[model samples]
Target: MHQAALLGGMIHDASHYGWKVAQPPHDWRKMAEAVQNHVKSLNWGHRVQLQDRKVKYFNFKASFVNPHMVCGVSKGGEETLLSADHIVIATGGRPRYPTHIEGALEYGITSDDIFWLKESPGKTLVVGASYVALECAGFLTGLGLDTTVMIRSVPLRAFDQQMASLVTEHMAVHGTRILRGCTPLRVERLSDGRLQVTWVDLASDKKDTGTFDTVLWAVGKP
Candidate 1:
């Protein structure tokens, strides 16, 4: 994802008039394709494979049958039961959406979608204070996109506050607009293909609004 942003920055620089020698215009479609291909390569061995080793891997829907037994259902609807001395669950998580906010799920994307975007998300508004939120906003700003991060409270609540401040400060120094102590109230789509967001500053108890091409929700993973 960072590579994608770097590629975008290079493209922007080459196209800007300040360059002494003009370079060929960047092909967004080609860049997007390259990013997708690279992502696919990274997942080449995602599936577990078994060969000469005793370890076994299964690609199916798994459920706990007992404390030491599991049942798996394959794509063909075949069921397999296996027993072991120990069991481990390693399934990851998905991004959490602000369900209480109007138009959140229907209009917003998550970190999962950003890497897979075929085109740039222009003038992005990233909502959250998690590391994921800051990272996404950082990349977007690095790529020369108009990016903003709205933090409802302290940034990176789970991490060291001082280090988190430095991270956010660096991002701000690089051009990411930071809105602290603010929470989004709602999001609405404009006819011109932009997102209009309404939010409130908790400290001031005042409302504000902004428009962006994309609204990303990165509150956290639950």
Candidate 2:
């Protein structure tokens, strides 16, 4: 996903600064295809399937052994140990919804779920200003969805102000609709599988509601 962003025009103004760097833009889809082929080469057991649950810890017994590095994995009904001299714990972070918002999970879709979408969204209102938000909105809009970015304060608040502003401007010119100074309250699911977003504009004591195909949360992502 990080590589996808680099190829999707995030590298234009990002390369000059010493902050973040990306290679010269190339065919992102091609890169992704190449990666997929490489992964297929390994012929690693069955494709890893998710049960949509949290992994509390590594159930390491360090006993069961195999010939390859990933000797064993948690699959079927077994937690067989893999044979290796060193094991790296690369389990990444978890999804965290906004504290004030309710039913985010009920109506919202996390980054993990976005890639597997079967249909393209007609409209997407992405919430949050972090890098996740920026990249997701950019990707969605680039794919021809009407993407609206909503932020409570400023987008990319953690980054340097200048770079963040540059990203914001680039996104605007490319067709991403950015709505600043707003936060989502809840996502209301419609019968048609679309979502109705209820958001509070921080600048004004008013509420706004709109229908969207999906709502992406990128606010201070955990």
Candidate 3:
């Protein structure tokens, strides 16, 4: 994920200064493949062990049956029960969308989808001020995309204010647009495949609108 950002920054700087460089246009498909391959390479040993039947991997949704037992349901609706000495809860989480925002779930994508996108998110509006939001916005901006970060209150509220300010300032110094004190109201899709977003400035109670190719909800994971 960070490598994408680094490559984007380098490309952005080169293009900004009009450097004569030979490089392919930012292709999300190619990037996604590269990322997946890199990850697979890093876990080759584990994959080999699983393939050799030395380890068992279950790709299913699991629930506890009792203190010493567990049940898992596979995608095909097959159930398997097993007893273990100890069970570990390692299931990961996903991004959360604002349920109150109209058309949010239907029209917007989350951070989870960004990394796997097959096409470039041309112009993006990332809602939230968390590290995930900032990091994504940073990379999108560096990739020469018109990237904006919308903050309802402050940036990186969970971290030190001074450091957070620095991070936002740095992003601003780059090409990332920052919208502070603003909260999204709704998202609507245009006929031409673009998204029209409506938001409000909390301080002034003023409403605004913007069109973007992507609306990413980076409001933190549940």
Best by TM-score: 3
Off by over 4 Å in 3: 11-24, 42-45, 49-55
lDDT of 1 by residue, 1-222 (tens): 577667666765674656655434444567678878977876554432333355566778889998999999999999999999998788899999999999899899999988777788889999999889999998888767799999998999989999998999889887999999999999998999899999999999999999999999998888
Which 10 consecutive positions of candidate 3 have the poorest summed lDDT? 20-29
Error in Å for residue 44 of model 3: 4.9
**How far is 155's C-alpha from truth in model 2 (Å)?**
1.7
Q: Please report, as a residue range, the 10-residue window in candidate 1 with the lowest summed lDDT.
A: 45-54
Given candidate 3, what's the lDDT at residue 56? 80
| Clash numbers, per candidate | 0, 0, 0
Ranking under lDDT, best-scoring first?
3, 1, 2
Question: Which residue pairs show collisions in model 2?
Answer: none
> In terms of TM-score, which candidate is stronger, 1 or 2?
1
Shift in Å, residue 78, candidate 1: 5.6
- Cα lDDT of model 3 by residue, 1-222, tens digit: 567768866765696787976665677778788877877787887778797986688777888899999998999999999889988876779999998999899999998888777788899999999999999998887777899999998888879999999999999999899999999999999999999999999999999999999999999877
The residue pairs in collision within model 3 are none
Angstrom error of the Cα, residue 83, model 1: value is 3.7
Better of 2 and 3 by lDDT: 3
> What is the alpha-carbon lDDT for the whole of candidate 1?
0.86
Report the error of model 2 at residue 47, Å. 12
